[model samples]
Target: MIFKNRLVMFLKRQCCFCGAGFLFAAIAFTGVATAQAGSSQPDVRISLDQAEQMALAHNRTLRADLMLISESKANEITAGLRPNPVFDTDAQFIPFFSPSNLNSDYMDNSAQFDAGLSYKFELYGKRKARIQSARAATVVTSSIISNDERQLRYQVATQFINVLYAESKLRFAEQDLATFDKSLSISQKQYQAGSISHGNLLKLQLQRLLFQTDVTSAQVAVVQAKDNLRQLVGFDSVPQNYDVIGKLEAPQPKLGLMDMEADALKSRPDLQAARQLILQSQSQLHLAKADAHPDLGTTVDYTHLAGNNDLSAFATIGIPIFNRNQGNIAKASAQITQAQEQERAAEQLVLTQVRSAYARQQSALQVVDLYESGYLKEAQQSLSISQYAYLRGDTSLLNFLDAERSYRTVELNYRQALATAMLSEQRLEESIGMSVPSGKVH
Candidate 1:
């Protein structure tokens, strides 16, 4: 009886251990699922303006361009500084071989010390020309940095729009799949009840597969778009599973083409940089001409020789006999011409870009308006009517499926049109080097 009791206790212990192990496993599985859910969710959501701010703060290329401005400023500072005066000291008649001839005192009989200071006086306003040239170069660098910021802003905005478009498509695909799921369930029941044929059920199943394919493609596109945006904004600043908050709707602006062109000419940083380059070249030409004049170097010296002290002063100048900066002057003149031509080219390019973007924007707006006015509503109504008719035995499965496909196509096309219009508007802003005021959407 005692042994039997012991066996019962042992069995109870075994049951307790088994229960504990099961409970542990359940907890572990729950934890894992929670972690997965959290990982799948987006860590951050940002608007277009916030995205632009992040990009400006974290973009490596933009940061590098900003550093160039500091470097140019440093050059300007260096150019404004005058040359340091030279100090000279010498010991003549030093007896290194014979210790007896060496002098213990600093100014002894057998040794002589000479010290002098020399300064080079820049002639023909050389220093002034250098300072001016450096200032002009700094202006060029500043303009370049400004242009880089503008371009970066445009890139970020475009990528942000792309992300929004991809997300919309993904949502549409999922919704379509869900609608098919309901239809598929109904079709399966009808087939089992002998109300629908096997062929019709098979067609519905195949249509579900197509929707599934679309969902997969849209998911991939979303991921790619987000990755591109993250890269532009900076990898560290954006999380892998972050979401963008923006619509693909284009905003209308009241500004005309001529106004845009005028703004572009006045505000385009690249054009300004090009013009600054012309000024820099002119300054360089003046500097080169100044270099043709010789500089004056003046020196003064004191000597203590054999207990006698003497002082001397002299000035030296180079005669501009042969090399009078002829080559540099020619090069600087040529650079001025080149800069002017480049500025003109930049202006033309800006105008062309504005026109192209305006055309695209107009076309996209038309398409979006057409879809929103009546076409999209009609497609949806047709699909709904066909679905109702099929369920009521008034239409075939083929007709219903055709309506579904048409609705999906129209919806996707509408989304694409919206994205295109938004992107074209961004391009217009970039070409004009300024943001147009947002107006009412059509």
Candidate 2:
């Protein structure tokens, strides 16, 4: 009975061990499967607006420029302040003896402490002009930053379009390859049955190879486009690639050409920046001209001589005798002329940029329309006919391959047109200093 009892307990323990091992194995298997599934899934998708926001936050270049604007603001603040006062103190010993003719055996020691406060009120309006100029310079720096942001947003939009284009091409290529594989299978059977020539079979096989090459090329393009988008948004790992569902549509811009010019003249950062420089120059000229006037100052002094102290007050005026500021006045006048010329140049340049940008935008719109209405439809028709001819045994494999190629080429061209058109519109708005409503800082 004892031996039987021991045998029963041993069997129970073995069974328990087996159950434990199975449970552990099941848990491990489940974990591995879950991990694989998670890895295979694509990343989260972001819309165009979301992408723009991300770029604004992460783009290193824009952040660097923002820092520069801060620095310029500091400089503007400094320009408004008056110069600090100067303090002087001096002590001299005359070798314990005065000069032979002056002191005549008297020992001399003297100490002087002079503290003076001086301020110029800028009676000629130079300081006010300087303050205005500094403020204008700040505006200019800010405008430059806005222009940069607009351009960056446009770039991100273009890259996003490129990624979508490459993905679309890859899908089409893969679909065509599958179709060619089936066609090649049919040709092989026909050749074996003596219903089709060996030449036709060879052609189909060659076309299959070509289609496979196309698929490979398209996949390479997709990788490259993804890398570019990643770099643009400062993403470390690849984002989940999603289909771009948006179509390019021209929105009726609320402003006319003349309106754009007016807006740009008022708000365009580059032009405003130039205007600020002109103002700064004007202020400098005022300063130079002000230098021609005499500087008036008052002085009060307390002196001790040979144990006697005396207090005196004096009003002084510097005539600028030898340097009567003639050269500076001429230079200041020249500077004013130079600044006026720059202002004119800036106005002309803004007009030219606006006109050119408008023309390009119009051309882009027309090009996109042409591709959509004409080439895209023709390419689709050609692909349909080629597909039908293959099934009917009327089209050679080479001819069908050419038609497929034409179709994909035209489709890619259409995508390119859409991307370019959007970029052109953005550029036109930027050129005209019209800010897009990007849901960020205006």
Best by lDDT: 1
- TM-score per candidate: 0.87, 0.72
Q: Which candidate leads in TM-score?
A: 1
**Candidate 1 ranges beyond 4 A from true positions:** 1-36, 95-111, 438-442
Displacement of residue 223 (Cα, Å) in model 1 is 2.1
Assess candidate 1 and give its TM-score to the true structure: 0.87
- Model 2 segments more than 4 A misplaced: 1-44, 91-129, 235-266, 322-329, 435-442
- Per-candidate Cα RMSD to the true structure, in Å, reads 11.8, 15.5
User: 5, model 2: CA deviation in Å?
Assistant: 85
What are the per-residue Cα lDDT tens digits for candidate 1 across 319-405?
Answer: 888989999999999999999999899989988988887777778888888998999999999999999898777999889999998
lDDT of 1 at 342: 94
Candidate 2 lDDT by residue in tens digits, 1-442: 7976676566566555656554554465456447546667555666667666777888888889999788877877776776454343344444435355345233232433334444434345555656766776677678778778877777777787677667767777778778777777777787888866655555565455556666666766766876777676667323544334455454333346766778778877667767766766666666666666665555555655454566655666776668767887687678768867877898899899888877776787788879867888898999889977975779776788788888877876776776677767667776776653322211
In order, candidate lDDTs are 0.85, 0.67
RMSD in Å for candidate 2, one decimal? 15.5
